[model samples]
Target: MSRIAVFGAGSWGTAFSIVLADAGNEVTIWGRREAVCADINDHHENRDYLPDVKLPDTVSATHDPVVAVDGADAVIFAVPSQSFRENLVDWAPVLPEVPLVSLMKGVELGSLKRMSEVIAEVTGAGEERIAVVSGPNLSKEIANREPAASVVACADEDVAKRLQAMCHATAFRPYTSVDVLGCELGGAYKNVVALAVGMAVGLGFGDNTTASVITRGLAETARLATRLGADPLTLMGLAGLGDLVATCSSPLSRNRTFGEKLGQGQTTEEIYASTRQVAEGAKSCASLLALAEKNDVDAPIAEHVDAVVAGRSTARDMMQAFIDRDTKAERD
Candidate 1:
């Protein structure tokens, strides 16, 4: 059995640890809070984040990063995208020369780098040693062992396949891909689209609006990703369309829920104060918009979402902006 180290004790981290252990891997999680670590060790439950789900017996937790990564066959990072650089910098010295997997799905703010890019820069790991997992993975459903499929991407096909085997469980199926850039871009951009969809929901718009935003958002994602040397077809696959659909449509989605709050006339600061979990889209929208602008891609939805998050535009203003834009060919 593989010894897997997961860094992050949040909902996704805990749920994914279950997947690893169910696949016959011995999983150890590194959590920031000693209470969380103790809960997992003593009860096999992360009551703080995933209180409803029970964890596998083979799964455990530690407060020390060294203990988590020591002798691990692979290390998975499910931390927040914004804090990833700081956290990895501190842990890199203790990390073994094993495959590093990223479960994050947001672009870095200042550097505009994908999580895989951040891993390469921070750990100096070659592309082959770095991987990412993404798709229509909603943590609660996965934690409950509901059937789900995802993509495991690495520059090296062999590495991707290996990881594919490591996390393949009865309820979780993983496909492999060599298009890391496409997978990463797909995962990141979908959150922005989900935010827009959430805004539409909050504004009392129905499926017609949601469908329009979802389709247009996929187009925007493909435009930016392909311009940056990703395969265009990848945008049509699980990472792009599948992820966008799930995140935008599901009520359980944090980004969609955050957008719904904004749509219901709540301020970003108010929402931030209310929720303990980070809504990734709320944080990633600005960086995603900046990345699109840098590449000269016209991403109206992302632009409006970023404006709303920055408090420069209300949800009403965002919907109006879309309606006021000049009519053009749908493909344009």
Candidate 2:
């Protein structure tokens, strides 16, 4: 039995810990707030992020990073993408040289670094030992023991297999892969597409409009993935299309909710002001736009969302722009 350290106490992190513990591994979670630790230890619930979900008692929470990772067989880095680097810096001394897996899905601002790269930079860990988990995973559904499959990708195939073992339950299935880059990038890029779909939905577009977005969104995602030396099929798998569909359709997805608020005529600042939950896509949108431009890739939906969020263009204006694009062959 492995002792798994989940380095973030957010909804997904907490739910993942429960999955691991249910799989018979010992799991501990670390959160920045002392109350979060108390909530899990005393009440078995992350009332702030995951209310009404009763976590198993086997999962413990702690404020000390050392206590969190002490003698753990492996760790999952589930921290917010923005503060991932900082947390790793703090975790460097406390965490053992165990294999690490990331649950983050965003390109780092300015550097456009992937989460695995950030993991290595912050922890001084080897690249091959790092891994990523991505797919159609919604915290609430997974916590409810709904059937779901996630891709566990790492440079080391054996590490991926190990993670798959730890992540597996009757309801939670993990598929192993040796393409961490594709899996991680697919997870990161899909959020931008989800935001676009949400905006289209909020603008009163019917099923046909949103359906077209999903198909073309896959095409655009594949183009970028291939340019980055990722296998095209990986984008078509659990981490890419699977994840995109789930994120776009689910009301629980923070990225979609963030975009819906924008479509409802709220400014980015105002939307954020109204919610205490962290919607990752807000930060990921601009960074993804920057990456698309830097790589000379065309990502119109992503670019427009970035503009809306940055206050350079209103959502209504962007919707008009989308409509003005020249008609072409569906796949052209």
Candidate 3:
């Protein structure tokens, strides 16, 4: 059995810890909140994120980051995209010469760095030793042991293989990729597009509108992914197109659900105040649009989502803007 340490006791972290434990690994999950830690230790539940889901008693919990990483063979950095850096700094002391894999999925603001790049910067880990797990994974579904698949990417083929071994499960299959940037970008950027699609649905737009946005959204994702040195095919895999469809259509996606609130006429302030989950797209939206503009890539759907979230226009106006976009080829 492997010694696995997971940072962040949120749903993804908790669910992943369960996956490892079920695979016969000794898993420890570190959480910042005392309440969350207590819940995991005492009741085997993460009430805040995955309520009513009982966890394995063998899956331990601690409030201290150091305890979590001590002597771990593999580390899963499962913190939210926004807070990953700061949390890694805390893990550096306890982390041995272990391989670090991230479960985060958003580009860093200002830096436009993929989650893998952020891992390299913060941990001084070689690209070969850093990897990421992402796909059309909806955590709640995975927690229920529903069948799922994801892509694990590393520049080094061996590292990708090792990650695939570590993460593969009866219900969760992981594909290997060398295009870390493409996988990361797809996982991150798709959330914004998912938000826009969900908002359109909430605004009473038909399936045709959703299909148009998703298809073009795939194009924009592949364009940026190729520009950033990822294989075009990876975007068509479980991490890219598949995830976008699921998140855009499902209520399980916090970003999509948040956008639905916006489309349903809730103010941004109201939505933010009403929900505690991290809707990563809200933070990533404008910054991604900025990055796309700098790269001279067209991402009108993402830009429209940003406008609605930032209060530059109502959701209805943003839809109108999409309708008024210049006619173009189906492939473009």
Candidate 4:
């Protein structure tokens, strides 16, 4: 059996640890808070994140990173995207040379680098050993043992396959892919699109509005992905369209939920105070917009979402802006 270290105790990290343990691997989770770690170790539940979900006996938690990372075959980093670099820097000395799995899905604010890139930069890990786990994974559903499929992407096909085997549970299906760039981009930007769809929902719009945003959002996502040398079809697969649909539709999606609040005239500060969780799109919108500018790609929906989240625009204003934009062909 493999030993896996999950370097965050957030919803996704906790849920994924259960997946690995249920797959017959030994899983250790490192949480920043001692109380959360205590809950996981003593009660087998992460009350702060996945409340009411019981973890497997093979899974454990620790506040010490050294204890969590010791002799692990793989290390999964599931912290917030903005804080990933700092946390990796602190944990780097104790990290073994194993497959670094990124559960983060936002571009670094100023650097505009993907989570894998940040991992390599901070930890000095090679591209072949860096992997990303992403798809339509809403933490609550996965924690309840609901059936879900995800893509494990890495530069090396062998590495991706190995990770796929390590986390392959009956309830959680994983597919391997070599298109790491496509997968990362799809995962990162889809949160922003979900915010847009959420705003539409909060505005009392119907299925027609949601469908339009989803289709057009995928188009914009593809435009940027292809520009970055990613395979266009990868954007059509699990990490892309699959992820976008799930995040946009599910009430469990933090990013979408945050946007819904914005649509209902609540401020970003208000939502932040209430949830006490980082809604990735609210934090990554600026960086995503910067990346689009750097790549000379147009991401109108993402731009509008960013403005709204930043308190520079309102949901109604964003919709009107879309209507007033210059007309173009469907594919264009």
Candidate 5:
């Protein structure tokens, strides 16, 4: 069995560890807190994040990064998109020569680099060695062994296939793709779109509005992806359309829930105080807006979401902005 290292004890990280173990891999997950590690080892449950799901026995946890990375055939980085750099820097010395898989979905603020790019820059790993796992992967559902499909993207076909084999379980089907940019962009921007859809939902807007937002948001994402040398069709794949549908529709999505709270007039501080999970969309929206600007792409939905999250605009104002836009061809 392949030995896998998952760095992060959050819901997604823990759930992925379970997937690997269920595929017959020996997995060791690394977390910051000693108590959380104890919980995974002693109880086989991450009560704080994934309350009801039980982990497989082959999945364990450690507070030590060295212990987690040792002898690992594949290293999965499931930490927050913002903190990936810091965590990888600390773990770089102990990182073995193995495929690095990113479970993060955010554009790095300031740099606007995707998670895979950040990993490459920090770890000095080549494109062939880095892969990204993304799709409608809601941690709780996956933890419950619900059927789900995701994309495993890398520049190297062989590496992607190897990773596909390692995480392929009956309940978790992974598709391999060489369109890493498409997969990465689709996963990252969908969170921003979900926020917009959530706001529409919170404001009591009907499916027509939500449907419009999702479609237009996807178009904007495709525009950006195409500009960045990605396959336009990837936006229609599991990493794109599939992921968007799941994140926007699910009550289990933290980003959507966070946006719903905002639409319902709760402050960011209030939401942050109540939850331990990181909503990557809230943090990634601004970065995405900046990237759109740099690339001269129009991303009105992402812009509005970023503005609302920054407290510079209100949901009502955002809706009006969409309504007031100059009439143009739908293709434009």
Candidate 6:
């Protein structure tokens, strides 16, 4: 059995640990909080994140990063995208020369790097040694052992296939891909689109509005991703369209929920005060927009989302801006 170390005790990390263990791998989770580590190890539950779901007996937890990664076959990082570099810098010394899997789905601010890129920069790992997992995954659903499919991507086909085997649980099916760029871009951009969808819901808009935003959001995501050297079909697959639909439609999505609050007139500061979980879109919109601009891609939806998040535009103003844009060919 493979020994997998997961560095994050949050909802997704804990949920993914279950997947690894269910697939007959030994999983060790490194949580920052001692209480969370104790609960996972002693009770087989992450009380703070997935309190209702029971974890596999093969799964355990530790507060120490060294303990988690010691003798591990692979290491998975499911931490917040904004703070990923900081966390990796501290943990890199203890990390083994094993495959690194990133479960994060947001672009890094300032550097405008994808999570895989950040991993390479921080750990000095080559493209073949890094992988990413993303799809229409919601932490609670996965933790409940619900059926789900995700893409496991790496530059090396062999590494991707190996990872696909490691997490191939009965309820969790994973497909392998060599298009790491496409997978990463699709995963990152969808969060910003989900924010837009959530704002529509919070504004009391019906399904029609949500549909328009979703369709257009997909187009925006495809434009940016393709411009940045990603395969367009990847955006059409599970990582892009599937992820967008789930995150935008599900009330469980943190980014969508955060945007809904913003549309309901709650300030960003107020929303941040109310939750411990990170809404990736709320934090990554600016960076994503910046990335699009750097590539000279037109991304009005992301631009509006960034403006609203920065307090420079109200949700209503964002809607109006979209409406006021000059008519053009749909493909343009």
Query: For residues 1-332, could you state the per-residue lDDT of candidate 5 as single tens digits?
Result: 98999999999999888889989999999999999999999999999989978899899999998899888999999999998898889999889889999999999998999999999999999999999998999999999999999999999999999999999997999999999999999999999999888888888898999899899989999999999999988899999999999999888999889988888888778888988899999999999999999999998988999999989988888988999999999989
Best of the two (2, 4) by TM-score: 4
Candidate 5 collision pairs: none
TM-score of 4: 0.99
Pairs clashing in candidate 1? Answer: none
Better of 2 and 6 by lDDT: 6
Clash number by candidate, in order: 0, 0, 0, 0, 0, 0
The alpha-carbon deviation from the true structure for residue 274 of candidate 6, after best TM-score superposition, in angstroms, is: 0.6
Model 1, span 73-147: residue lDDT tens: 999999999999999999999999999999999999999999999999999999999999999999999999999
Candidate 4: give the clashing pairs.
none
lDDT, residue 72, candidate 6? 100
Root-mean-square deviation per candidate = 0.7, 1.2, 1.3, 0.7, 0.7, 0.7
lDDT of 2 at 202: 78
Arrange candidates, best lDDT first. 1, 6, 5, 4, 2, 3
Candidate 4 ranges with C-alpha deviation above 4 Å: none
Candidate 6, residue 328: CA error in Å?
Answer: 0.7
Give lDDT tens digits, candidate 3, residues 216-257: 889988887787678888888988988888888788999888
Lowest lDDT sum, 10 consecutive residues, model 4, at 315-324
Clash pairs (backbone) in predicted model 3:
none
Per-prediction TM-score to the true structure, in the order listed: 0.99, 0.97, 0.97, 0.99, 0.99, 0.99
Q: Among all windows of ten consecutive residues in candidate 6, which has the lowest summed lDDT?
A: 314-323
Candidate 5's C-alpha runs over 4 A off are none
In model 1, state the lDDT of residue 237.
88
User: Which residue runs does candidate 6 get wrong by more than 4 Å?
Assistant: none
Overall local distance difference test of candidate 4: 0.92
